[model samples]
Target: MKPGTSTQSALPKLVTCPTCGGDSVYAPSNPFRPFCSERCKNIDLGAWASEDFRMPTTGLPEDQKTDDEQ
Candidate 1:
């Protein structure tokens, strides 16, 4: 341990690339490190735009029936 080394300098214990799933240096302070680069981030965005990711929703009512419909 170097005298100038601060405890905060320690990198993330887990080394994993979130996007490409390749070797990556994890950091608690890094925002895009897991993605490796911005390109990966865009890929993820495209997936959502193309409906690759679907989220369930209650959705709007289709029929205008009364609340007391038997």
Candidate 2:
């Protein structure tokens, strides 16, 4: 153990990449974290920026709903 270094082992954990559906390393050593690489991470971010991903909601019209129903 060194002065500025902590006693923690960095092991690569398998994770599914959100953009490519592939294996990725989920560890602190990986700058992309859950994503496999810079490309996959950027792709996922692009999807968010382009509104490719959305949250599910009821199909009811906004005007048809009461204030309490919202």
Candidate 3:
């Protein structure tokens, strides 16, 4: 054990990447956080911009439904 290096009590949390389904670092040190890399992050952003991703449809009353949903 080096004097300057201290042992970590626990391992860093490895979160599942939303884009690639690979292990991703969820710590502050990871700039991409939930995503594995900039590429994966950008891919998710592109999907949002292209309207490829949509929120779950919740059944609403006929009057509450949006014009597009109707």
Name the candidate that leads on TM-score.
3
Q: Model 1 over residues 2-52: C-alpha lDDT tens digits?
A: 797779556454566656886665665656666656787788778888998
Better of 2 and 3 by lDDT: 3
Off by over 4 Å in 2: 1-11, 61-70
Supply the TM-score for candidate 2.
0.65
RMSD of 3: 5.1
Better of 1 and 2 by TM-score: 2
Ten contiguous residues with the weakest lDDT in model 3: 2-11
> What lDDT does model 3 reach?
0.89
The CA lDDT of each predicted structure is 0.69, 0.84, 0.89
TM-score of each: 0.46, 0.65, 0.67
lDDT of 2: 0.84
Question: Tens digits of per-residue lDDT for model 2 on 1-70?
Answer: 6688754455457889888898988887789978989999898899999999999987877579877786
Q: Sort by lDDT, best first.
A: 3, 2, 1
